[model samples]
Target: MRKTPARTRSTSRSRAAVVAVAIAAIGGTTLVGSPASAAPSGDTTQFKGVNWADPRDNYADDPVVLSGLSTSDTYAQTYAKASRVISAFRANLGANTVRLPINPYTVNGPYWKSYRGVIDAATAHGFKVIVSYWEGTGARKDGFIDDPATYWPMWNTVVKAYKGNSRVYFEPMNEPHGYTDTEWADLAVKWLGTYPSVPRNRVFVSGAGYNDHVTSVCADPRLKGTYLSLHHYGFWKEYATYDQWVSDLKERIGNCASRTVADEFGAPMTTGLDYNKATPDNNSINFIQADTDTFRQLKMGSVYWPGLRTDDTYSLQKLIGNAARPWLATTNQSGADRLAWSWGRGKPVSP
Candidate 1:
């Protein structure tokens, strides 16, 4: 999983009359007492440029409340759980986006048959799938995958499942955060499987340092076809010293790839609820707070970490993008990279 966003402090709100007019004109909805302002309506179009998993409703702040997770509890049950996850967020059911982090075990293990089932359900719903996976979470898994060389096979299989579907965007890994250029060389370019008309170009891989995709690893020629990803949080102010924090966190990527997105970023569960109590007035006003705007402009697309946790994470979601939170229209698709989705009616649920 990627790091989440930080929470913002909010004290007041505009009059009910103002909210009414904004909602009516913009098809508006917002999180209460959050930075009160305009919101894009349900008619707010979904992700524009790339298609990946971002069903805010899935376990966060979506319209349709999602259910079932026993299958995802363990690798043995991954196929079963993955099936339910995809089924729960079907596209035709009004779920246009999904966050399917590919489970290599379930995809290549004995339960592999069930992995295909998830893809079938995705096609049924018309979702623009984002297939991401988490590997050993280490520098590299040097051993050859003899038991399950499912990498190429999975790609070919998933692409074929959609019947030449263009909505699917394959993300190779979750956080290749600390990897060297050579580490990604194999997955990015040299693979053993055949294409079978599948588009390897659609497969995206994370860059270095968690989700700092553009700054660290997007330069490899082998990674020519894929996009980059980034992650940040509004709470950075609470931890690091401003002198060391602001400059390091503000890694500028003047434009490296065809597309780059803030895969995750938001406040913590603790701060969101008592944000006013925790974040100092001075800290809140620091440059760390500039992330939202800087990211919105630099990445061109952003998806805040979910405020809605498996339990009640609204404390955190409120600072990100939640209809219940009432922040600006700077979510799944409201701002840029062209992929973020907005809170809307009939949207699926997060948890």
Candidate 2:
């Protein structure tokens, strides 16, 4: 599903206060630390993951509170709740990685301490975490960094906290549809230069144009070592055959499968779509089948758009049991089967 336009809310803060918090949070680490050793080539397939998103689809002017998490909770409380949710993701979906959304409001505000719980719980459980920056809502949600002043400081705080952790990866931005391809590449170059301490392999450079394609970013020599993130949805096409979908996706990827991961691709899971059987007339079914088949054939890693979201029809898993200690139930077994197949497990379906 396509992202809904972000709703507006004010997030003004004292610049000096934000900086002070960042320095204290970093514990004296330099804003730009010395460059780390070169990163070895990575295997994208190791990232069998799902996105744990806010009920608002991770687009919020305020702090992004993920499903099953509450901002009112203390750090320890958030950690405990997150542990249960992360465990549910693994048990229900076989996920080993989780992609999370972060914004200045969450990282540079009072919520930072508590938000760390989500990251900590995921990593403690041996799940790789992809922390991506999401832009603000309403007028500020124009596919651009709302403010670089806050943006740089936000990254400083996050990089300081997780730079040492190998399982925690950083994605500079979600989907930069505002800039031209060349401009986006340049910005990514700047991000790499600013944080030489982050291993290249641990960074995910989003594909340009609402993250609809990766070939442009992949072709840039400056972005060579970082993994590229791609977002594809069935809504992008009104209707297409299985082979047509395959061709469309490949054209966006070009020769970059080795360094590409479809981190945001999903379809209607709760709609009772039978992805296991051929459904040429059903766009959602065709899209899911084609994308999963292509991913498996290419040996590429893919994270579903959302493993859990409150009200999205495309959510692969739904909350169940006690709210305090939440667990998940798969909304559609066939969708789960398709996800498993994409991850190199489960039986393949005929096209």
- Per-residue lDDT tens digits for candidate 1, residues 284-323, read 3232234443443343444434422333232222122332
- Identify the runs in model 1 with alpha carbons over 4 angstroms from their true place: 1-67, 72-96, 109-126, 136-156, 191-196, 234-254, 269-289, 307-309, 312-351
**lDDT of candidates 1 onward, in order:** 0.39, 0.84
Model 1's lDDT to the true fold? Answer: 0.39
Give the per-residue lDDT of model 2 (tens digit) for 179-281.
6676667777778888987888899999987888899988877776788999888777679999999999999889899889999998888878899999899
Best-matching candidate per TM-score? 2
Backbone clashes counted, model 1: 39
What TM-score would you give candidate 2 relative to the actual structure? 0.90
For model 1 the TM-score comes to: 0.53
* Candidate 2 global CA lDDT score: 0.84
